[model samples]
Target: MFEKVDPQYLLEGVDGFIQEEVSYNLFYLITGFEEALTIKSCDSKVLFAQSPRGNPWLWVNRDLPEEERENALKLLIEYLDETPLTGVSSEPRTAEMFANLYGARYHTSIKRRMDMEAYACPQVVKPEGVSGCLRSAQLGDVETVAQYLAGFSEDGYGIVVDPASQMEAAEIMVCKGGLYMWLVDDRPVSMAQIAHRSPRHGRINAVFTPRNERRKGYAGAVVSGLCSILLGEGLVPMLYADMVNPASNRAYQKIGFIQSGQISDIRFE
Candidate 1:
């Protein structure tokens, strides 16, 4: 039996942030409609020692608590040792640079060396009724969207899991994201997610529509509309599309998103 975790208390430690088990999956129940959680998290693959030194980042938030923050770094360091990771990435949780992930120093280093490439941001249109509208999603829309996403299996992107598992996971993403859904006449349609919100940039997650819903000008509108909102909010928008899909690449191109970098998925032992 699982005891419901208190958000305030569980966020007290690094393990809490890395492997937070909430009462009712608040992130999903709350976000309305999100891109769904499909990242390669060891969240379910491994168990944590109560006082483990290292942590993992399950959620990306600026207002992370003290216990969770410190522990998360410890967890990140530990996890790095176990997994064959290329990018020793970390987020700037604080000002002191106690443990630098991708802090000011690292950014400065990359800048000074001229190793990092410069890139422009993507801009999506805003959602509204009539032409292009983005409304908050409901529980009922979950099944439909979930079914549509199953088509994007690991066979293609090197990320695979049972479709049923994907649906269960998506529930959590929608809630934590305050997700917004696109609809037509009472029927749920396309979906987009908002994340990485900040002064520098905001990331867009899982912009998708059903296979049947494709070519109807839905995705173009959704991506554009969402990007527009982020731009309006003074945040540069970014996203990664499967390079394999020429159609998708074209869609983003139409919206003014330039090629950022070569994102690869390496699954090896």
Candidate 2:
């Protein structure tokens, strides 16, 4: 059976796991979110969590016997009986199993929304011959950043978003001091963000370079520069890349990121 547990329970013996595995579980590190829910199997082989801002996430310890893993998932579905969930995210197989069982129970159809590969960079391999240097984004860069944000959404996920609609988000990101720009000859050519810092790793996201700037190595330069900053602070850099985007994956790999695991995003319709 799965029982509701305090989020801190996840940290027990976490040191034994590599940072890549721990990155997916960082949602549990979010504290004092009244809407958050966390649960674990009695044997502690399976974990499920949901934060207000995201879909429910499942983590099944691969070391567990297959039969035990199946039983735990069954109990999890039962525990969530009638609970409304729009979707789930997890390592591919776990997400598929949970989505199938949950969809059957609710009579809903499941669709795979995205397949993402988690990556970690232990050492940065900055691209040479890139003229741009990394600088923290400021309020003056909001307009440019907004456009880049909109472009990132459309290009990376095929989502149509207006640049004006992203203005507020751009301002917030810039003000947070995590947003960065790769400036060449005083012009911003690429952008990236240090989305969040977990205990041992920092996540980089929103990497984008305009079509006109593509193939110029700006994306690699920006991401590698951010990785160096994180490393200076004693934190490893990690990010999730869309499995369908070979270009972005190759870029990250060129900068020293190693594929760690895969996560599937499934939606119920």
Which whole-number lDDT from 0 to 100 does residue 90 have in model 2? 84
Residues forming the 10-long window of minimal summed lDDT in candidate 2: 14-23
Would you list the C-alpha lDDT of every candidate in the order shown? Answer: 0.47, 0.83
Off by over 4 Å in 1: 1-132, 154-163
Write the residue-wise lDDT of candidate 2 on 81-146 in tens digits. Answer: 867888988888888888888877789887547999989999999898889788999899999999
| 51 Cα displacement, candidate 2 (Å) | 0.6
| Model 2, global lDDT | 0.83
lDDT of 1: 0.47
Q: Write out the backbone clash pairs for model 2.
A: none
- Per TM-score, the best of the predicted structures is 2
